[model samples]
Target: MASQWHSLVSQKIFLARNLLGQLENSNSVPAKEALLQGTIELGLRARKLVLIMIARMYQHQHSQPDSLEALGELIGTHSPEIAELNQLASDGRSWWNHLEQLERHQGNPPMARKTVSSENVIAVAADTGPDRSKQALETTLGAMKHFIDILEDRHSEW
Candidate 1:
């Protein structure tokens, strides 16, 4: 499991680096366009994956508080990048997201939203999941924001 998570983290780092490269190169329009579009998708996906890892980390995470805390801080610093990527993806939805989504799904069944049929307003307890993950989410968001800054900053060489 640790190795699996390590792989994911490594891949995320690679993706982040690749995004920066693509943004800075500006040599090929089509590739740049694809990178501009893919960045958001990767950000969203990475956020989801990191949340899962963090969620697992939360279980008895007291033992490794320092590492977990560092992870949270890193994620916080990275969030803006994710948001910007999202904005870029939404700016036009171009053709990249579609193509990537299709490739990812690869004919898998589309995810469906299950409707609740509860008629009783039996006061449902407040959400546990969101509250638990809120900090981690904020941390990841911060990281994304920083990444966005790096991606958007003007490069003299470009």
Candidate 2:
């Protein structure tokens, strides 16, 4: 289970970075649109995986519907590391929520097949607020990395 969680985090990180690379190199409007959608999808997936990692580390199963909140409560009882982890989890949640909003605004739920115009695609691609940037994605990934480290360090206890 731990290995599976780690693999999920790694895969999501790779997908996010790969989408960013494609976004960077994209020239045509349609290509950029597609890549931007891909980035949002990756961000959302990353957020889910991060929460799942935290949940699995503390609890044997990731069945908690609101794992982020549960993570806060669990980690809150820890040492001084709570502050940093809380901040990361908060940022991760906020950005993930924003990405979800963007997805809804695009009328394209994750893994949904729908035909959208280039203009509509551009609009969704440009849906950037403070929370929906590359930095947010990076922050979320960093938090996941920290969670992984903490779990690995205390694996014997678990």
Candidate 3:
């Protein structure tokens, strides 16, 4: 069971890295969009898997974290990288969900109506442009790598 979880985590990290490579080389708008979405999805999945692995490895009473933010807390350590990853995942998920919804209005009187188009959605996802989105993905990849290393080191102790 432990080995199975390890294998799953490895696969997710590999897939995310592969998607990042494709995203870097993608020049077409549609291709970039698809790659970006894939990267975000993989990053989130990898994070969850890492959290689960950590909980299992440490023999936590709960055996599962309530949320990404709860992982570090459960382990009795605080990691800024984990926090950053959480934020990145949240932002990416929001952007993706927003893209699906297209237009959103706020307030009972509709104080403001925000309409999202493909071009602007991409920009918003990255905070400004593709460069930012790439940076976010890279950050997520780095954090995943860091956690995986920690998981390996801890696993060897048992």
Top-scoring candidate (TM-score): 2
TM-score per model over all chains: 0.34, 0.57, 0.56
lDDT of 2 by residue, 1-158 (tens): 65677678778767876776666577898987786667667766765665566566656484543445565675454634345445654663644445556656566444644588775564345333334455665665455556656755665365
Candidate 2, residue 29: lDDT: 82
After superposition, candidate 1 runs with Cα above 4 Å error: 59-158
Q: In candidate 2, residue 75 scores what lDDT?
A: 48
Could you tell me the lDDT of residue 117 within candidate 2?
77
lDDT of 1: 0.44
Clashing pairs in model 3? none
The lDDT-based order of candidates, best leading, equals 3, 2, 1
Residues 38-96 of candidate 1 have per-residue lDDT tens digits of 65445455545543444333343333222323545544535543344345446433222
| Candidate 3 ranges with C-alpha deviation above 4 Å | 60-62, 69-132
lDDT at 71, model 2: 59
Residue 65, candidate 3: Cα error in Å is: 2.6
Of the candidates shown, which would achieve the greatest lDDT relative to the real structure?
3
Task: Assess candidate 2 and give its lDDT.
Answer: 0.60
lDDT-best of 1 and 3: 3
